[model samples]
Target: MSNIIKTIDVTDSLENLKDVCDIENGRIAGKIFYDQAIYEQELEKIFARCWLFVAHESQIPNTGDYVTTTMGEDEVIVIRQKDGGIKVFLNACPHRGNKVCFAESGTTRGFICNYHGWSFNVQGNLVGQHESGIYEASDFDKAKWGLKEVAQVDSWKGLVFATFDPQAPTLQEYLGPMTWYLDALFDNQEGGTEFVGGCIRSTYDCNWKIAAENFVGDILHAGWTHDSAARAMLGGSVAKVSDFEESYSVNWNGHGYEFALDTVGNVAVLGESALNKYLHTIKPSVAERLGEFRSNMIGAVSSCTIFPNFSFLAGQNTVRVWQPRGPNKIELFTWVVVNKSAPQEIKEKWRKGAMMTFSPTGVFEMDDGENWEYCTKTAKGRVTAAQDLYIGLGMNSRASDTSLPGNVFKGQLNEANARAYYQQWFDHLNAKSWKELPNRNFGKQEAE
Candidate 1:
């Protein structure tokens, strides 16, 4: 926590925002899915304060390379500077607030805004203007008219992140124990991971949290929601996720995942024999590099969500940032991840495998968006939004092993992660500052 008071000023009270989630009693209010005021509060408290994924280091390896993304509704440009450092800037030009960069990603020497011909270099410095003589004698200061920069920018194993709040914790401190689990996906090999190609973007008519929470720990839905996808890909075999032994949902801070140590079970679901074999062949190497405990997660049945709306499939290797378009909609950006050291063929297989299973039109991905959309659409009803949704499954259950790094619960069907996530959500919304936020998720003590 910072010594400075980093607080969100959502002064107006919302009638439906109160008691949206009661972690103590395992009650989840449907209004969390779609409430205008709650959504605005989230933008102020969560997105503006927390570290959000912006772009991968692999995406922009050279100077002047850039990518455009969003922090809540504020569009930002992530560019590689001439000094080899990365910088994130608000995409709007200071001249008239028009977007300086229109392309999602490409190499650029500088941003020349068509609105006023205001030119900014890759370092986010205003270097030129349409006419130099007109403003020469005026009181205009070119130095103060550069693009607005984000407060912090950093990366963990090639995954770049940025935050808007200057008083927020550093990227490493924010990640905490979540990095321990993330190693399986990011640092499984010596070279670490990189995005395979450009991302696949799609629009979803759903609250971002609905899709995020699904990946966080809702493994129970895999059997029913994606049954057709399983039948289509796995030759009519569905991996039983309900009571799987050696599987757990680990919650740390607001990040969480549900996983089964059934090695290659997820890879097999890709319906690709080559990819399955490749993952199987690398098990010993991964185990030696990481550990037997962590390596077992490779090609396993798992899904994870990092705090607010960043999600990915572990074995499937598709990363997603569920960008909030509004309370009732999201713009999902999808990318495939592969170990940088892997062979070209292996990397290609991983890319295709992820696309086959988790891309926008992929079987599993197709099954999820509609359900989330309907769940969000239903919350618009006055009676429906007021009612509490049941999240009492595995209620009062404690992890048999408190030695785990986080709040780990045995079984994939538990809603413990969902409860913990909402706890964090409410904590962010209710706290006066980041210093006041409670952090009891990671500890030796069992979660009550």
Candidate 2:
């Protein structure tokens, strides 16, 4: 309910975050993209509280399998236990606060701290150290010195997520209505999906919000920014930027998807003819499982973001996590996804195809880094950072239909989703807890 920005005090800045985006009117303050206090609040309120992607279940199918990842900026080790359950532990050693495991991923019986040899098992219990009897009489209970564990770890389909806040909602509830669209990416095959091979990590000199918001509704940029990549791919490796009349932007809570509902347009551009053919064979099945609307989404020309920082290109076969580094920087982790039951050759094609377009050095990926970086860099200008950006393009473009899920907008070019996303960003920073966030049953709503 507050709207003013006059101080750098943490409390004042957080209070003013509500002023950063005016969803009702379609306007946003530029500083929300690079403000330090805002970023600090996000690390605590949003990243720590919301469910965040860690690793795919495929990455750790057996006991002791593990992957090192970050929830917000806090490094964590997400590992499978002997019971075939996953647990996420803070990677910092309790002994001296040094990193326990440095490897990005691997299978192991336990983790040994490199600094002091303080070791912990997959369950995060402190097992031993260099000397066994050194602290026995010193009131040091080894049982109390285990690595900090996340309060929650869960998965939907094959994607794993974790959260540090004990009061955070279940991952299923956090995902909210986004599940309808997620099924298109995840539930396409009988065996579900898994990430193919290793992920690609790269950094962008931009705020995490800037990159996340881009995927929320910036498909309009497709026609202009990525045209060259589309041309260079010889038109077959990327879908044509479609006319506004054929596309849609839909959001639920803060999660959003923008797509041209041309079913095979997404995979067709991967430059894998057989992959396209394969998807065609299953299109009927997808339609039957999810109905005609989401069936068209299985391989459509689309980009989506699940609130906070996780995003993926529906047709491009790339999944991304925009990890925040600081107010002015973000680390991007990219992965190619394929059906768990897919043919090995088809999975390989997805891997290579995703690499060709979204890897660190891929054609489409190269075109976006600088643009995002510059957006963050330029916002440093004192005057520029204070201005309000006009996001009113689709202020009245709402689509009222009970058939489609989420807050649907009529066109992909609209800024409705971006506005909704920023509003959620504001709400998270301003709320006392997750319980204070908005909750409205969305049905028969319009996008305008």
Candidate 3:
């Protein structure tokens, strides 16, 4: 254990506003960039307690269809039962703790443990126990031994999520004001957005937060970090002060905001002419159906991090599951969320757009990889790792908004959303349950 980690005062290291807030500062203080100890606590406090995305409803549409993955460190299998409801359970066997299902994902009428032949149905009910003669009914309570269920499982739009903490709030309550914005993106559509296909899986050598933060708040990197790639794709140089508009929003359970430039507008300026022509041709049709804003974003970049770990980038049309492998490593599950009923041609277009923007070989993805690597490298240094990180962007810019809850700023690029995320993160780290959060702010904002 001694060789396993180093500890830093997160509270103290998080104090210095200027240095912490400056992107340049984050570039400098490298310790927190990738620390194992910080990652461990994140699993217990953040991933375990918060609502981590599991799979989209589209992934498991029919009864008994399932997908296996991890929520924090606990392996989980989410299945669509016969009744059309969703259930999430530990993918472990009740008998000997062996993994019950080894396949990554598939439809299953039920599962039987390979080690002991203990069988369980999709509902997680233990149907049979091997060697039943020796052990009486009293030996194992089938009722008590049903595969351990996740504490809470819920869906927002078509996205499914699970929590390990029994006291965690329902998905809607936890999303807070962000729900309104999410609805605009996901629900306002014809049938809500469904995932395009199976996820795009990859791994990163940096802290999970690096990916999360970059997805949600780091819109400043596109033009430069991706400069060469952008030029190659567009056949021209990226504009120095690219007119990309950015914004941020915050929710109670650390949910964060992102506002991005319109896809057609930005892509036309920075992408190939052929791609731009295709986008322009399809623009009118999409705008006619989904309306101008969303249709305009058919390939535009929009994104948000719903606290803890679920992040989606709209411009890229990629929904990401940042599963913490540890403090310094994370497994990325990237899925393209689209309307299940979209025209086959449109779906194909969306797929192509996703491939060009966020796929493993995408230019944007390559740019991010470079930065994520550098961010993680800093933590290996002894002298630089001790400095505090910052979130003080547009500190004075925060103002209460009647249009939106929490706090809102006129322009989107401010760090108020990031600060709000940390505030909620601190709350979760300290509180044992959701019951504590309301008392802390139960009616303070409403009372005011």
Largest TM-score belongs to which candidate?
Answer: 1
Better by lDDT, candidate 3 or 1: 1
Better of 2 and 3 by TM-score: 2
| Worst-scoring 10-residue span by lDDT in model 3 | 1-10
Give per-residue CA lDDT, model 2, range 1-448, as digits (tens). Answer: 1111111222433565546677787788778777787788888778877789999999999999999999899999999999889999888988788999999999999999998788898888888988767777676788878888887889999899988777777887777667878899899778888888698999888889888888988977776787777766655444445553477888877888988778777677667888888788888988888887778888888889988999998867899999999999988999888888878999999899888888888887877887888888877887888788888888888886556767888888789889888877877777767667665333323323
Clashes of each: 0, 9, 13
Candidate 1 stretches greater than 4 Å from native = 1-10, 13-16, 400-402, 440-448
The top-ranked prediction according to lDDT is 1
Provide the lowest-lDDT 10-residue window in model 2.
1-10
Off by over 4 Å in 2: 1-15, 236-246, 439-448
**lDDT tens per residue, model 3, 12-115:** 22234233234322222455456565555566667777778898888899999999999887898999999999998888886678999988889998999999
> Given candidate 2, what's the lDDT at residue 443?
38
lDDT of each: 0.83, 0.81, 0.66
